[model samples]
Target: MIFMNMIFVDREKELQTLMQRLNSPTFELVIVYGRRRIGKTSLILRAISGRNDSVYYYATERNNLERFREVAQRKFPEVRYAREDWESLLHFLRDKVVIIDEFPYLIEEDKSILSTFQRIVDENRDSRTKLILLGSSISVMEDVLSYRSPLYGRRTASLKVGELKFRDLRHLGFSVEEAVKIYGFAGGVPMYLTRVTPPFLDWVNRELKRVDSFLRDEVDFLLRYEFREIGTYKEILRAISMGKNTLAEIRDYVKVGGEISSYIKKLERIELVTREVPVTESVRSKMGRYVIRDNFTNFWFRFVYPNLSLIEEGTYEITEGEYANYLGHVFERICREYVRDRYRVKKVGRQWWKDVEIDVMGLGNVKVAGECKWSEDVNPHSVLANLERKVERLGHTVDRYVVFARSFSTKEKMEKAELVDINDLNSWFMS
Candidate 1:
C-alpha cells in the first residue's frame, strides 16, 4: 500500500517505438511480458497517454468463463454478451487501441479464448486499430505467444522489459555508494524503489516488518503464479541463494538426480537465474556457475533468508550488530560495482586473468585496475603495487594505472600513478 509519485524514466525509447508501431495503417498486435513489478503496465500506460485514439485496458482475473463474460460485458457495454463469436468482438471496436493485461488469466480460464483472440486479430488485420497484450506470467506468455505456439508470428512486435540498470540508479537520488548498496539489495524494480524513503534506516526497518514487502515474498509468488513445479523451483533458488553457484553443486544440493537437468532448463527459460562461464580461452568448458539474475533476489537469499530466525525471534538488534561487523566488506563490494558501472559507461568491457581480477579492466583499450577505499585513509602505495602485479599477471602494458579513492590520494602517489579523486569520481558518473 506504500505509494509515491509515479516517477517515470528510462523508457522513452520503448514508448517511442511502440508509438511508431501503433501509428502504422496496418492493424498491429504487440505482446509485452516481463517479471512481475518490472513495470509492464506502467510502460504501456505512459506510451499511450494523451493519445487521440481510444484505448481500453482490461486485466483478466482468476475466474470462471461466466465471470469473464460478465466482466467483458461490463467493460464493453456496447458488445452484447449473447454474441459468443470472435467477429462480434472485432466488430464492436473501430480504430481503437485494445490492451489486455494479464491475458493469460483469461486463456487459463478458457483455452478457447486464445483461438477467439486469434480469430479476432485475423479478421482485423487490415484495420487501423492496434491490439497490445501484456502478461506477467513468463511461462504462459512464452508458451502462448512464442514462435512454438499457435500465436507464433502473429505478433507485430514483442518487448521483454528487464530490471533497471545500476547506472540508472542516480535518477532516484542515490549516491554511488548508496546506489550500489540499493542495487545489490532492492535492485532496479520501480515498485521496490518507491519503497525507498528518507532516513534510509527507517525505510529498511519498515521493509523488514512488512510481510507483503517485495523482498520477502516475490520469489514465492513468482513460483506459485508462473510454474507448476513450485517444489523444484524453490529447491533450485534455495541452492543458488545458499551459494551453490556451480551446476554440479546445485544438482547435489537440490538432490534432484535425473530431474536436476530438466529443472535447470526450466529455470533458465523463466529468466530467474543464469549460468556464467569464465571469460577465458576455454569457452566450451562445463565449468560454468549459476547466478541469480536479479540482484535483489541474490542479496535477499544471501542476507535475509539466512537470518530469518533472528528476525522472527525479534533479535534483529543483535543480528544488526553481527551485520555491522561485515558491513565494511559489503561496502567494499559495492565500491567495486560503482567502478565497474563507470567502466561500462566509458565502454570498457571486462577482462580477467588467472587468479587476478581487476576491479575495472580494459579502460579504453588500456589495462586498468582500481581499488575502492571508502575509508578516509586509502593506502595508495599498496593499491598501486597490487595494480602493478595485476598488470603483470594480465601480461599487458597499459598507458595508465588509475586508483579511484573516495578520499584524497597523496600527491606523491598521484605523481607516481594516475589518480582519480572523489570529486572526479562524482563528475564521471554525473556526466
Candidate 2:
C-alpha cells in the first residue's frame, strides 16, 4: 500500500469535504463511490488516516457472513459475543468510525444485510458511530442508494469521485501539450495517469507489445465488472467511439435485436458513456447524441481494438495517417472539460442545429461559444467567420467568441475572436 502522504494530489476539496464530515457532531453514513481506478479507496483511507477510533473493513465474496463476523470480532474483541446480530455488533461499535470497503460484495452474499444495516443505523442514529460505505462498482453502489433499496435515504453524505481535471493533471509534471496528449489516451484517472510517463506514445507502444499489459485488458475488465453481457456493451461502446453518435446509428451498426436504452443507461450511470443534447435543447430532446465519455476507452476502440492483430504481432508499425484529425475532437473535449472546471459554468456542452455544429458552448453570466482548430496554421478569419455564422444560425446572441488553435498565421484575422494556442492552456483552466 502507498503511504497516505503519497496518495493524495490536488484533492484538497475532496479531502476537506471528508474531513468536515469526520469532525461532524452527528453520526455520518457517507457513501463514496466511483468507477474503478478513480481513487475512491485512496480518498477514504487518506481521509481517515491517523484516526485512532476508526476501523477499516474490506468485504469479499468468500462466505461473507463468516468473514464479516470474524473481522468485526477481531477489530473489537470486547464484543465478540454480540456478533450474532448487526444491531448489537453496531452497538458495540458505537462512537467509532467504520469503513466498509467494496461493500457490494457483502450485499451480494446476503442482501438481507441492507435492511439489517438500515435498522442498525436507525436504532443508533443518535449515537456517535460514523459509517462510511465505499465501493468502486458504480452500478451496484447506485442501486444501493436507489429509492427501492432499504437504505435509500439513510446516507448523510454521498460523494462521486471523478477523474482529475486539467489543473489537477499538472501535479503529474506534464506540460500543456504533453498534458493534452496524455489526457487523450490515459485520461484523468490517477492509476492510468501514473502508468503513462513522458513520451506518451513510446510508453503506449511498449505496453501494447506485452500480452499481459493492463492497458490491453482494462476495457474488458471494466465491462465485465458491471454487466453480464460484455459483448453487447463492447459493441455499443465501439460503435460510439467510431462516431455512431445517435441511437439509430448505434443500433444499425451493432444490429442488436433488443432495446439498448437500459444498457445505455447502465453505461451512463457508470460514467463510461454520456448522452449529449445541445445546450439550448430540453432534457427530453430527441436530437441527443451518445458519446464514449472516457478518453482511454475511446482511444482503445479507435486505435487498439481495431489493430489487435498488429499489436499481437508486435510490429509497432501502426500508421499515423488517420490520427491527426482524431486528436482534434479529443482536444475539443479537453477544452470543454477545462472550461467547465475552471469557469464553473452553469452549462458547458456542444451546440448544434441541423448540419451546423459548434465545438463548445458555455452559458453563464456571459455566453461563450468556441471553435477549435487542430491545425498548424489556422485561418483565424475564416474560423471566426464560420463560428459567427453558426452563432447567428443558432439565432442566439453570444457575448464572447473564443477560438483554440495550434498556431495562427496573422494577428489581423483574430479581431473577431480570442485566439488560444494549444501550448498556453493554463489560463483557460484557471479560476
Best by TM-score: 2
Tell me which residue pairs clash in candidate 2.
none
For this target, which candidate reaches the highest lDDT against the unseen true structure?
A: 2
lDDT of 2 by residue, 1-431 (tens): 32233237767888899999889989889999988888888888888888878878888875766666677777678767775666777788898888889898878878798998999889878988899999888889988889998999999999988887656667666777777778888677888888787777677778888988786778998887687779988989999998999888998988988898888888888889998899888888989999988988998998888888888888753344455666788889877876676556789989998999999899898688899887778887888889999999889888778888877776443454677776557565442
Off by over 4 Å in 1: 1-7, 51-58, 64-76, 85-87, 211-214, 280-285, 317-354, 363-367, 370-376, 394-423
Question: Candidate 1: worst 10 consecutive residues by lDDT?
Answer: 317-326
lDDT of 1 by residue, 64-92 (tens): 34453454566567656456554565566
Deviation from native of the Cα of residue 210 in model 2, angstroms: 1.7
Q: Model 2 off-target regions past 4 Å?
A: 1-7, 84-88, 316-322, 337-345, 426-431
| Candidate 2 whole-model C-alpha lDDT, 0 to 1 | 0.81
- Cα deviation of 395 in candidate 1 (Å)? 3.7
TM-scores of the models, in the order given = 0.83, 0.91
